[model samples]
Target: MRESLKVQPHHLERDAYLYIRQSSMRQVVENVESTKRQYALRGRATALGWRDEQIIVVDNDQGESGASAAWREGFQRLVSDVGMGRAGIVMGLEVSRLARNNADWQRLLEICALADTLILDEDGVYDPTSFNDRLLLGLKGTMSEAELHVIKARLRGGILNKVRRGEYRCTLPTGLIYDQSGNVRLDPDTQVSETIAHFFDTFSRVGSACQTVKAFRKDGLLFPSRLRNSQTTVFRPLTASTANAS
Candidate 1:
């Protein structure tokens, strides 16, 4: 009854914009239920008096992060439509789905307020033009941003714990490999081991990275570089950057 009062005929006359998003491709693939729940909001729009054709599902943002609106084309389109008074109601499964950033969320709320557009989540219908609804929406946006921060903090803490315990496995640099037993060991290839030893020997003698690179170039020595994605090593002319990194 209260939801019906907030959604006016004027709102129903315009299109209902249903914005859908997931933070990562992993979520889009593994979290099938969540995606289905978001798409099911089309039925919610129908219940709010929007026809099938009048409901626009903006799902281009799938597998994209909500930390910012800079790279989200779907979010930009929704904001543009709302600002142009084309969207009668903007719907999402939750505020976090719409935007996890306070700036992006508040901007959307402001535009919806000015356009007299409604915001619909699983909770209830909210009229952004109404002061009370606007405040509640603001709080939800803030909470969404806070929620993201908390998740990141927890993940960082777990990674740091793993690092302290020497359990964190990082990519091995060139001339090093993780053996079958997952122990760090030198490359089995004698050429790779010899090249790395010679480079260091030159570096120690030259006492300068730039001079070491020049020495390799002058000696016409090709450095053995291991490809990141494969165990194969390729010999290439060593640049200052590569020498410095080594």
Candidate 2:
């Protein structure tokens, strides 16, 4: 008869990071306790013979709205730090903390996979080198993409509802005005808008954005995206004339 042996858990050492984020104030209050509990991931690292310096933690407080990628400042830095090879692993309270949007979420996951970064959750560790983990990551990214679609749908519905109510759903076009009832109306005095429209029409007929730009320069017109002097003229493209040439 063949003898069976119990397998010992794998023992290895690697740097790790703990990234935490909250979607709203509710998670802030309710999750802080759980958030502190996130330190237990450090214990996991410790068991692997990794020390404290090899680990990092990043968390966002009172973070809600989950829509803006710019909201998580520390999280973004942590990602950068990890990318620089300062650390070799990343952990989060869960997948949602990593990203609320598919783009950012998938980006972090891809970095981890490519960098051979291990991901840990309360259930267990995820080794990116594993074939099954890569496949599971793909599935999770797809699910996150679906989540992104739902969020965009809700935002579109809300904006459309506001528009249907005859309410201003967003700011006036640049150079327009908000009247007393908060309706946006064109400012008759700002000839800039008509100038811009004419420029676009002329450009379409001219067939080159660059040639149209030259025409604007000849006529002392300016692009809104371009910088302007106190007097403001596109003919003197400030960036071009002032900045060192590439």
Candidate 3:
């Protein structure tokens, strides 16, 4: 509840948009509390004198990254409504939920300012038309963008360091596994190991991936592949393209 947010009669005549978003699908699935908190903003709008119909929840962007607005249909809709003078207030958990990219955030700031729309977050309500509020929001957007960069840099650096130490654990290719002690080796399954060895031997003799694939097809052989994020191994038809890539 900000002093500047007086809820004028004209504001009551317009719609209130509740924007809900999470940076990734993993977060959307794991961060239940954050999703609940974002959805709770609809109650905030209602408390601010908006009827149920007057409040719009833009949650289609949920589980999508706020890093860019290009693919965000919900965010695009919100912006279109605000630009068309339909939005009285735009509420979210925070500015970062609305946008992590400064370009998108600044564009939103400009639209809200021009349309005289109010913005509400966990901190408080703000009028983007107000110089102080707009400045503060711009700073927050910059900080969010910088935060994304810092996080990516840290992750990349960590992965690189692990790689240099021969300790990086990426998704294992077919017929390979890491032991309890983190040493890379052929899969423990003898049949799988033998099949892989046969494939390589055949490929060496053929001197062409296309010929290897033909040989496998002629022999009715299947390639072993591990399913993602699982311990299950499956067999699949190996094509010429797949053989070349492997």
Which candidate tops TM-score?
Answer: 1
Better-scoring candidate (TM-score), 1 or 3:
1
Q: Per-model C-alpha lDDT, please?
A: 0.93, 0.60, 0.89
Pairs clashing in candidate 3? none
Model 3, stretches more than 4 Å misplaced?
1-4, 172-226, 231-246
lDDT per residue for candidate 2 within 1-246, as digits (tens), equals 010011012213445677766676667777778767666678766665556876666765336444546766776786687576555667776665666566776677777666666666665566666688767765665675678678889999988888888873454443455667877776554555676567668667877666666666777765442222222323334133222121
What TM-score against the true fold does each predicted structure earn? 0.75, 0.51, 0.74
User: Alpha-carbon error at 234 in model 3, in Å?
Assistant: 4.8
User: How good is model 3 by TM-score?
Assistant: 0.74
Rank list by lDDT: 1, 3, 2
